[model samples]
Target chain A: MIEILLLVHLILAILVLSIRSLFTAVILMAIFSLFSAVLFFVLHAPDVALTEAAVGAGVSTFLYIWIVKRTQKEVK
Target chain B: MTTTLAFDLIGYLFVASSVVSLYRVLWGPTIPDRLLGLNVASAQILAILVLYAAKEKLHVYLDVALVYDIFGFVGILALTKFLEKRHRKGE
Candidate 1:
């Protein structure tokens, strides 16, 4: 299970880089953060898991989206 | 023993994932892409810290994760806000 999770995580990280859309990258990173939170909880760090769940998965993505929103390419 | 082994396995896996995300931070074409990469790496680091705290049975180390959680969001939020301001000015 650990190996499988690791493989998926690494692949997704690579996908984030390779993908063209910044929106997709933000979403992918949020997903990755969720996975990391689960991984942390499994390891018995409940506090950290909670923080990652709330902050990384939630707030960070919101901030990224906010930035991405205004910086969008001007439609010609 | 099995549980400990499992924890170790998962922890290492997260660490490896963060390493891969570093490439995006270094070479991303757009600023948002690079920030996205940074966000991923920092989130993983928080998880790694928690895993380490569990492994060492040191509850206090969890404080680092908490602190990181607070500051990480603030920093990112501020950065994005700044970007938004600059972007609006450009237009």
Candidate 2:
């Protein structure tokens, strides 16, 4: 299970980097955080899980979306 | 021991399904579809947390799961609101 979760994390990171849309990348990042939090919990670190759940999944996602919302797309 | 094994099996099932659901997020034709996939993924994570808490006899994880649900809700809400405003702005 741990290995599977780690594999998923790697896939998400690559997808975030390769995806065309910034919005999609932000959403993928939130998912990445979600799994990492779960991984922390599974590894017996509930404190880190709590922090990651709040800061990574919640605050960072909102902040990223906010930044993405305000920025203009670069011209090709 | 069987119960632990059962919980492990269920966790694997949830993980597999969530992974399959990522297909929607990756190939989604629209923003809302990706958001829906994200919602599904978070819910599955919450379930896995509860399963672990039960399996290992750790009550504290219950609180983590609760807070995670709340955070997922708020994150999705904020994303939708941002998308709505962007839609109104025409890009």
Number of the top-ranking candidate, with TM-score as the measure: 2
Per-residue lDDT over A3-67 for candidate 2, one digit per residue giving the tens place of the 0 to 100 score: 99999999999988888778888899999999999999989999899999999888999999888
Please, what are the lDDT tens digits per residue for candidate 1 over residues B1-91? 9988988788778868877886786567777777787788887777877777788787666775776677567656755765577588884
Q: Which candidate ranks first by lDDT, i.e. highest? A: 2
Error of 2 at A6 (Å): 0.9
Task: State candidate 1's DockQ.
Answer: 0.06
Docking class of 1: incorrect
Residues A1-76, candidate 1, lDDT per residue (tens digit)? 4555576678778887777666666756765775676566656667777777678765787787777776863222
Interface RMSD of each: 9.3, 0.8
* Candidate 1 regions with alpha-carbon error over 4 angstroms: A1-76
Q: In candidate 1, which residue pairs get closer than 3 Å at backbone N, Cα or C atoms, i.e. clash?
A: none
**Native-to-model Cα distance after best TM-score fit, residue B74 in candidate 2, in Å:** 1.1
